[model samples]
Target: MTTSPPLIISVSGIRGIVGASFTDDTVRRFAHAFATELPMNARILLARDTRPSGENFAAVAIKALAEAGCHVFDLGVCATPAAKLMVLELQAHAALILTASHNPADWNGMKLVRADGIFLDAAAGRRVESAYHRSKRRTGDGRVESVARDDVESRLLRRILDVVDVDAIRAAHLRVAVDPCNGTGALFLPRLFEALAVSAHFIHDTPDGQFAHEPEPIAENLVDLSRAVTEAGCQVGFATDPDADRVALVGETGQPLGEDLTLALAVQVVTERRKGPVVTTLSTSQVVTDAATANGCPVILTPVGEVHVVDAMVAEGAVIGGEGNGGVILTDVDPGRDAAVGIALILESLARNGRPLTELAAALPQYSIEKRKVSCSEQDLQRALDGLVQRYPEALRHPVQDGVKLYMEGTFQCPWIHLRPSNTEPVVRIIAECEQRQDAVELCAVAEGLLRGE
Candidate 1:
């Protein structure tokens, strides 16, 4: 018998493989539950990435929301960040984006946004989850309206252009390569490059949801993008996940600058101009910390989630914030991970510094981060984490509120390991970083051994 992946219900939202755990019935029920929590006839925004199942799932959600007495304004085929920006621009009461982010084409999920244009925080998310399980559907005269993709795209582009050094970038006359992985970024990156007067080469530009490779913008998956950069003589290469919320980069020499450096480079740009605290998740690379420190900016570490980082960004008045996994958040534009904004900030850094991407990356403090996952029951996960605590008693530990993060030395930039249960998958994720690749690999191996009760 073929078993399906379990549905991932987390603070981020619900994600699962389509036609199995996540079906039309599942979509309708969740949509109804989401709507029942809103005001009667409340204004809501709806958007979806280019997953093959997204169109149908979105229709199911639209019907459920309208039947539950909410007006839906649909932004068909749009980036996740675009959907977020439109929520504020249109003053919609709430928004629901149908996307599974970097997950494969067979997967789809719902990301619920509050009125403030941010993903639901833990408390708000809990409310939605509770409603999903307990609330019943209601009916009223509600309607669906179409919001043009151009408007959504323009609003996002203008936000990014407003903050970046457009003049400097234009003067640089930079050539770039983009691989949107046949997803939402294909819809808007061309327009953005045109506006910035950047010469761009695009691959996997089709928005047909049939991904050219794995949807994740990791180094191994971006070989084509790297080749495009070198062959086309581009200064940098950008690869965005399906919903365009995350981006990984390829440097001028066709070298994949792992996702962690994406935030480090952006931090270098932002902290150079704006001197405020920088916020990042605990699992983010220490290079980001080094970048912030070099610019005399304070660094704040949050639990491993975008909402956690965004919350800290708001409280600390952070000039910039993001995750290690190629997610960048600039509160000036949106309090969410935005690939468009990340791309713009990176380009501006190259332009203002008059440096190549490879050189700029090399100048930052370097660290090697290795990630691995092991499937385990929750009880076993807790047991292994307990064992780690006993084994690393002398190590400086973090808050333990989110996960177990401990630094070998009593400092922020030292070799470190973090073990946390995955909210998006049925496994425990182990991340470790060290000054050398071999050390990082060894650290993860240790974590894996502990996880296996060895």
Candidate 2:
């Protein structure tokens, strides 16, 4: 039998195509590695999204953790953020979430979290990689167990209620529409709204692996959500990816707020309540920075990944952080990217301000961001970065920590252009932010041209 391609491991987590790079053996190996790295007799939480293959992989992971002599808490069919919440709620030493967020349905992988409920940073991830390569062995009579279904949702709800004003949300008498995109969000969001006493209209809320539309919450893929917001005549609409860790929103006007606004709005809410530093990835829109500045808060930019963002948040003592892709992290609630937390925060902001979602979003700085990916061999990336630096010497400011980000001074109405190579995929991502859509388009075109050595 042919061996599957090596799993793609990183600071964020490990992911690969199910049958190809991510196989049963690979899952076991990684799980064992994680088990070995965790403290002795430590309790570990295992959760997965609604992927068809997740149960099988989760089973393998449970066994591996048990064999490595750790108590396993099986939280079947939970959102990635829910898993993070469980880790903190149970005070488990670690968590393993089986999901491939925004990737195709056929893909599934594991996201490992530490005791603090944050994705492992590069240093921690490297330790796991080292342990995997060393093939460390531990012997114990540990066993795997399942969490009671009756306890799951209630426990999650309690954590959520602690941070959000459930009473205020219910008093607002909000009618909201939720689209889970056939992911794990379907499992918790409905119950969350019910507990808040808010009327919720659900679409694709079934926790099935089958996806009704593309799992990404990008504007182009959110046509159904936009229409649902209008058809349901709800005050607002919310959508999440397969894992439900990321979220996107639609206004009462049935207009998509775009994913970037999700984080910006959430940040605004958090800063308004308690001003502090915020964190986001480099590829995020300038609107987030503008919002932070307006709130008299500074924004720290990290590389593009949840791990990087979380690390920065911890380091900076940020009160709020997230990526522009609709993933919001509230340190007041949890340090992980939590869609549920984000939704509650947004609703609370609406309740406090007594404004429609559209008007609230419109109040933020407006900037158009365009993202494009180009196929390029790994060998060509260095040359491309070199070329970018040489070509835009005067206009370029390189923060080589992540992928190369180019700051074009006064070139466009917006601040900077970031061109970063994908760590897991064989493509370089070009992200340009500007006040004008045409300017963003032109920036992407120019960056793509330069990266391709045109």
Candidate 3:
């Protein structure tokens, strides 16, 4: 038996700070739990970002998989999407990615992938968690030393190029700047841009597990990337978190565009080309609907999280879908949140339209989204959500398994508030978006207060 680290075990997976909350034993136990979910002689894909602890965790994972009688395909230091793609290609029974995503450099975690190349849905995630609690251990002789594939980058780019207008983008010869924040994206984004013939200036491109700035690609953390775009004389700038699953872009003239534009632009591109349903999360911006409506396509709203969005997209056969956090999931190419796919789609949108990213974004509906993060115990997270519902009795609630989202009545706008527990941390994420920024901020503040019992 091992002492459990101070970890946040949610549907997204297990997350904890390295050397403290994420200890070696926790890694072994979680790996064991994940391996228990696999069948005998199952093949598993294992990968990670550039976090310093990644190799150590991967080592632990290899041993656990080997002991569980599973053949492991170790894709060392690859993007989250790349790991999932390999799972689909290998017909593996399951996959695991060691990445804390946008969390700080000190944090590390795991993302469990199913055989379908998607993260396990809520039910399956719960089963894995249950297996963890039950100490489900499988003993068998697997392999000790595993071979790690090096072609994950090229394989991922192949899918992107196939879905996008490769030639047009190459012809455009657009200049772009990117900040991968010293994570796994540094391994492939530059190469992908070079393959597309797009001139790219990469900052923090070294895969040393050292973050140059805050890992989240939000506006506040992208000042340097925005400046780099201007200094490099680039048309746009790009930023990706550690795992490179989400991408935030900077428009021309070195201005930070909201992360929402990534999905909005991708939605616009797809809906204009194909008239179909657009699936997105409840927490996403209304720009999705605006883009969808312009092309005579309806928008379908699902719960927050990549799996839920992908599940909805696959079930509905939606042409495009993703989250507002700069995640773009093109079902034709991939059904997961992928920054690489988003970049390709956005670049294609730029190339086909012969317009700037700024102009393309300006053409969309203008809405303000205010987000607040509050650290809370799991009990308090639920209590706050319950309080919000009690406060607004007449509000319409959305059906999302992870969080509580309510459309409240207001004079000018019916603000929607999505209150959900963080998938990666011990915090509650309160997001409110509306046509007016002030309204959204106020709603977010009110929700945060309710959650805090103020």
Q: Which candidate achieves the best lDDT against the true structure? A: 1
lDDT of 2 at 43: 97
How would you encode candidate 2's per-residue C-alpha lDDT over 67-101 as one tens digit per residue?
88899999888888877877888899999899988
Clashes of each: 0, 0, 0
lDDT of 3 by residue, 1-454 (tens): 9653378777677899888888777778777888887888788888889998899889988888888888888888888888888777777888889999998888899898888888888888888888877877888777643444456667777888888889999999999999999988888888789889999999998988889998999999999998999899998899999998999999888999988889989888878778888898888887777888889998888877788889888998899999999999986665588898998888898899998888888888788889888976777777888898888898888766558888776421336888997777777899898779999998888888877778
Candidate 1, residues 167-229: lDDT per residue as tens digits?
999999999999999999999999999999999999999999999999999999999999999
TM-score, per-candidate, Cα-based: 0.98, 0.94, 0.95
Q: What C-alpha lDDT values do all the predictions have?
A: 0.90, 0.83, 0.84
Error of 3 at 47 (Å): 0.6
Global CA lDDT computed for model 2: 0.83
Q: Candidates 2 and 3: which is better by lDDT?
A: 3
Which scores higher on lDDT, 1 or 3? Answer: 1
